[model samples]
Target: MVIGDGILTPCISDSIVWISAAILVGLFMVQRFGAGKVGYTFAPILCIWFLFISGIGVYNFIKYDPTVLKALNPKYIIDYFKRNSLDAWISLGGVILATTGAEALFADLGHFSVWSIQISMCCVVYPSITIAYIGQASFLRKNNDLVGDTFYKSIPGPVYWPMFVVSVLAAIIASQSLISDFLHNPTIPLSRVLPLCEIVHTSPKYAGQVYVPEVNYILMLACLGVTLGFRTTAKIGNAFGIAVVFVMSITSCLLVLIMIMVWKSSLLYIIGYVVVIGFVELIYLSSVLYKFKEGGYLPLAFATILMAIMLLWNYVYKRKYYYELNNKISPERLKEIATNEKICRIPGLAMFYSELVQGIPPIFEHYVKNVPAMHSVLIFVSKKSLPISSIPVEERFLFRRIDTDGVNVYRCVARYGYRDARSEEEPFEKILIERLKDFIREDLAVNEGERLEAVAREIEVLDQACFSGVVYLIGESEVVAKQGSNLVKKIVIDQAYNFMKKNLRQSNMMLDIPHARMLKVGMIYEL
Candidate 1:
């Protein structure tokens, strides 16, 4: 099924092929090692590529012959349009090629500051491109030939080869970057998460920068198909341009909604962003729509498929995540875990294990039945995956510890990402403790063969300040009873039997009704 170059006649130029190869190789290296540095290197190189093309475009424009110009006037553009309006619509299939690269811009926001991207666009990309496009216009008028081929021939010596190489590679890199943006930012912040609030919240890790493998692969295939199938830049750009404009148009609409109702700010902000996006989209749309007869439908068809996939994937992933979380809460087990605690002789200390931190749990009512006098200090324990490799101080601040009426409640919550949690064999608590020790000892420096007694001694001091007199583990009922405890031990165990019955295992509520003895209610809070 090898189609000869006959179908792709215009790509016979060795120079163009060589340039494209260089651009591809350069980007691959950049993607691997240039995460934070891409903007500095990439933006400048791209700007140069744009300027070089624009310069050729401008030169071609100024030197257009008068006779040739007469035939290529607006009439030719209109006639070509009118004669094949339907065909032009079909050609829109190719428009997908242009916007395929736009996702990369969003993905790279973290790598480069927003201001840096803007600066590169203004200083290098825009002006150079303006000149080249003008040259393209002029060249078209004089030669009555395919504009891409004309521009290629006009380049002096080997310069054409390098320019071609740069242009194609830059285009592909740009495409890959856009795909990355979508994977990292899944939520519709203003509309879904924070509709009433003006400011949107995001963790530093979930910032606008992201990479999407699916989108990248799809784009690669689409771009390769267009390149090998058509061989002429003009034919590809026509279709690519339309798809780019369509995506831009949708993005503009979303941005406007965010600016108006979501942000609900002033008119100046709205108009400025809208106008810029509008102008760019309009230009591309005009190009693709006008060239419908040549080739455009190819991109439009591909873009429609891509957008549908994006919408569906987000919906399913979020739903499954929440479902598993709610299923883990247990009432009966939480009660058994909370009740078996040892009341310390130390006056202010209180230690008990219960899965209930938030909402109604059996442990809260149990405190009312057993001990009328609540202990002054409370320690709540939870089992989760290991601590983060490096816990940023900001992440540590997420927990709130407070003292009320000589009683201290320490509520500990643990977290684990999907990769580590999916392993079936290992117990979570052991992994969690190891992680905590690693985090606490992260900065300690000692020879590998040397004992960690000195570091351990220092860490114990810090731990005493944090862990001190009473420590409780909220775990299973069987584990709590079998562990064996008396008043002497500072540690308290909570099997969380009630919590397991209520939340996780879902037991009958009537069992605790008749003999229901409620204890002095401790702090009532929900997770």
Candidate 2:
């Protein structure tokens, strides 16, 4: 709107809305290609933007009242606060916009080195922003009538068109950065927070650079809605101010917790941190909350709805996990079932995927009780994610032989880190087979005398049998409301959890197992 109004007449400014919408849609559509391809293109443009703003700021500051620099003095801030009090505090909400993108520094830490980001900010961004704001203030002091369009009006006549172009480009780039952060960061797994969608990782070098088509379109549609509904920058800025202050307050609170728990800081340090950061953020948060009736309510409304969904998901998941832990069969029970001659044995290898590491899942027992048959080679597989970024390939899988019967029963645990890519390029069956082969070779090398011979013989038979085929088994379990449960539990488990389970990506698809060889055993839990 500023760019269109600045360069063109009022007639052309109306068309700028549709133009902005089209550009936003185009930016989101190109996200599937990944950030690595597009991130570099923005760097030079951003540099130019900073330099231009700083240069204009310096020029304007020198031409107008150089005395305006006196506003930087601490006494002026103190005097203004003392004089206006509540009004001054309320205006601080507008002041937060000056530091809008500062949070991105911490967010982009995953993409760039700390030292590099610090150097860039210290040398270019901070100085540029400081001078640019001072220059805007100086320009406004002289030309009070042009306060609404100060940025465009301050530009020199000769370079107006070029400056307008740069402003529009910079605005689009800024919007793109925020949209990408919303889609990728907060570290929430798409399967848990959203419905099933293909999440494409664009950069192999940076696991954080992901593109979700569903999220991208959703964001685009939302941007269009806000743009059309508000039809003015002032209303949008009001909502934007609420969102910025809310995020800042939340970030400060999280940092305080991290300092106490992760850094193990002293009480003195905690008090100082809270007094410095918390005081400022709380003031801003309170100011924004006061404006809740005037467009500020939009962000709080959205956040409340989202928080309810996440809380319900957490509750249901915990209940289901507790139920599974209590119902899991003991290892002795599994051995007894394995040794039973009454159970007919089938010919192929069967891998049952379950959540428990130490015991047999109820789903497996249910499958066997109904069919009255077990596979020649039984393997229970569990894939667990650790808190770290990536696990070493050598330490990825752990295998242990369970029962000594002619039909071999084994347990395999595959460990992965949170950021580790579970590439679908290699099938799960193939990886498991290779890991098992490695385990056999290692066991043969380590064991002495009679044990070595036994291991070799077992490996030979296992190799031949595995060559036949493999079957992947997983449970399709659902949680139902148990008798005497409260209303909240019933609503959370029977309704919310069931709805999410039905909509989310299935377990077999997530594991990348082939549909033809996969068996999904349906089961119900009265929890």
- Using lDDT, give the best candidate's number: 2
What lDDT does candidate 1 reach at residue 62? 62
Q: Write the per-residue lDDT of candidate 2 for residues 231-257, one digit (tens) a residue.
A: 666555566677777676767788888
Q: Tell me the tens digit of each residue's lDDT in model 1 across 281-394.
A: 665566567766676566555545544434433332233223324533344443333343443223333434443444233443445355444344444543232222223322
Model 2, 185: alpha-carbon shift in Å?
Answer: 4.7
Which regions in candidate 2 have their CA more than 4 angstroms from the true location?
1-16, 78-87, 185-199, 385-395, 415-427, 444-453
Highest TM-score scorer = 2
TM-score, every prediction? 0.49, 0.88
| lDDT, model 2 | 0.74
Q: Check candidate 2 and list the clashing pairs.
A: none
